[model samples]
Target: MKLHYEVDGEEFAAAGQASGNIKKMLKQLGIASDVIRKISIAVYEAEINMVIHADGGTVDVDIQTDKIYIALKDTGPGIPNIDLAMREGYSTASDEVRDLGFGAGMGLPNIQKNSDFLKITSAVGVGTTVEIEVNL
Candidate 1:
């Protein structure tokens, strides 16, 4: 199966809607609870990152019999340093974003931890694309 989501840049309150929908779909598909949890957390973090930093984005999810793949693409200001961004406590979020109780900087690290295969491509002025896969 394949799913697509559009991350909204204008609404923080709607940040996790796509992730929530993915969670429900996983449940209805009888995916393992642990797998569903990991997907949920990773998607939530990615969605929030799009809303908070990327301005907006697109997410494509592909579910296979032996793995699940998630690909996210954003046209926002891309990461200047992919290495730094992957660090658990590094963040570029402003005080406004932090005020929302986000920007703890755990997004990429958590996604890596939960995914069996992960790849990130970014350019300072261009954009970013993150692809992650979880083995079944």
Candidate 2:
């Protein structure tokens, strides 16, 4: 099955809607609870990043019999250093965003930890695309 979600950058309150929806769908589909939990957390963090950093983005999810694939694409100021961005506690979120308790820089690391395969591509002036997969 394939699912696609559009994430709005202006709505912090609704940032995790897509992830929540996916979680529910996964439950209805009889996916393992642990796997669903991990996917939700990872996707939630990515959604927040898109909202806070990028203006907005889209996520595509493909569910296979043995694995799940997720792709998050954003047309925002891309990461200049993937290595630094992967580190926990490293954030470029603005003060306003930080005041909301959103950006602690755990997004990428958590995504990496949860996924069996992860790939990130970013161009400083262009955008970023993150591809992650978790095997069942």
Candidate 3:
């Protein structure tokens, strides 16, 4: 199975649309609850990041018999310090966003925690791409 989604930038109301759809699809397919949980969490965090930091992006999901692969690509300003970005409780979100209680700086960390494998590539002036793998 394959799924593709485009996240809208700075759209808090629609942040979880992709993740919610993926969750519904997984449920309808009778996927393992634990696996579904992990995917939802990872996808949600990635999706939110796309809207909050990346100014929107695309997510591609490939579901295989033994594992699942997800890729998120963004065209926003690339991550300046991956290490800092990965750190828990570290954020560059504006006060306006913080007021809405969205940015706790745990997006990437949460994705890493939920996926079996995680990879991220970014350029200062280019963009960012995140890939994730989950075992069945």
Candidate 4:
């Protein structure tokens, strides 16, 4: 099965909508609770990153018997340094974002921790794409 979601960058209230929906779908599909939890955490982190930094983005999910694949693409200001950005406490979120109780710099780390496979590609002036996979 495949699922797609469009995230609205300006809508903080809707930040987790995609992940939540996916979680529900996984539950209905009888996916194991631990697997669902991992996917949910990883997707939610990526979703929140898009909303907070990328202005907006698209999330595509592909579910198979062996694993689940997720791609998050955004046309926002790309990460300048992937290595730095992946650090547990490195974040470029604006003050306004931090004030909202989000953007503690743990998004990418959490995503990596939850995902079985992860890849991120980005351009300085263009955009970013994050690919994640979790074994079922």
Candidate 5:
């Protein structure tokens, strides 16, 4: 199965909509709870990152019998320093965003921890694309 979503960066309230939908689909498909949990967390964190930093993005999911693949792409200012961005507490979120109690800088790390495989490609002046896979 394949799923696609458009994340809206302008609306914080809509951030998790895609993730939530995916969770529901997983449940209805009778997917294992633990697998569903991991996918949910990964997607949610990626969604939040897109909203908080990427300005907006696209989420694509491919589910198969033995593995699941996810791709998130954004046209926002790409990470200038991926190594630093991977740090658990490093974040570039604005004060206004932080005031909302979001942007703890744990998103990417958490996504990596949950997925079986992960890759991130970014261009400082262009955009970013994150791909993650989980084995069944």
Candidate 6:
């Protein structure tokens, strides 16, 4: 099965909508609780990142018998340095974003921790794409 969602940028209140829906679907499909938990956390973090950083973005999820694949793409300012961004406390979120109690720089790290495989690609002046895979 394949699922797609469009994340609205700067919409903090709506940040987890996609992840919530995914979680519900996973539960209905009888996915393991632990697997559902991991996917929910990873997707929520990615979704929050889109709302907080990117102007907006798209999330695509593909579910198969052996694995689940998730891809998040945004046209916002790309990460200048993937290595730096991967640091636990490194964040470029604006003060306004911080005021909302989000953006602690743990998004990517959490995503990495939850996924079996992860890949991120970005261009300085263009955008970013994050691909995550979780083995079943």
TM-score of each predicted structure versus truth:
0.95, 0.95, 0.94, 0.96, 0.95, 0.95
Evaluate all candidate structures by whole-model CA lDDT and list the values in order: 0.87, 0.88, 0.88, 0.92, 0.89, 0.89
Q: Give candidate 2's root-mean-square deviation (CA, Å).
A: 1.0
Q: Residue 103's C-alpha lDDT in candidate 6? A: 76
List model 2 lDDT by residue over 5-112, tens digit each: 999888878888988887788888898888988888888888788888998899999988888888999999999999999999998988898899877788899998
Question: 24, model 1: CA deviation in Å?
Answer: 0.9
Worst 10 residues of 6 by lDDT: 7-16
Give the per-residue lDDT digits (tens) of candidate 4, residues 27-101.
Answer: 888999999989999999899899888887999999888898999999988999999999998988889889988
Q: Which candidate would rank higher by TM-score, 4 or 5?
A: 4
| Model 6 Cα lDDT, one tens digit per residue, 17-119 | 9889888988887888899999999988988887888877999999888888989999988998999999998889888888988778898999999989999
Instruction: Give the clashing residue pairs of candidate 3, or none.
Output: none
The candidate 4 region of ten consecutive residues with least summed lDDT is 94-103
Model 1: per-residue Cα lDDT over 1-136, one tens digit each: 9999988889878889888987898788898889888888887888888888888899898988888888889998999889999999999889999998988889899988887888999987788898888876
Candidate closer to the true structure by lDDT (higher is better), 4 or 5: 4
Worst 10 residues of 2 by lDDT: 18-27
List residue ranges in candidate 2 displaced over 4 A: none
lDDT of 4 at 67: 90
Best by lDDT: 4
Summarize candidate 3's per-residue lDDT along 1-136 as a digit string, tens digits.
Answer: 9989988886779889988987898788788999999999998888888888878889898888788898999988999999999999999888888898878888889999999999999998799999989887
Query: lDDT tens string, model 5, 29-134?
Result: 7888899999899988988888888888999999888888889999989999998999999888889988988778888999999999999999987999999898
Off by over 4 Å in 3: none
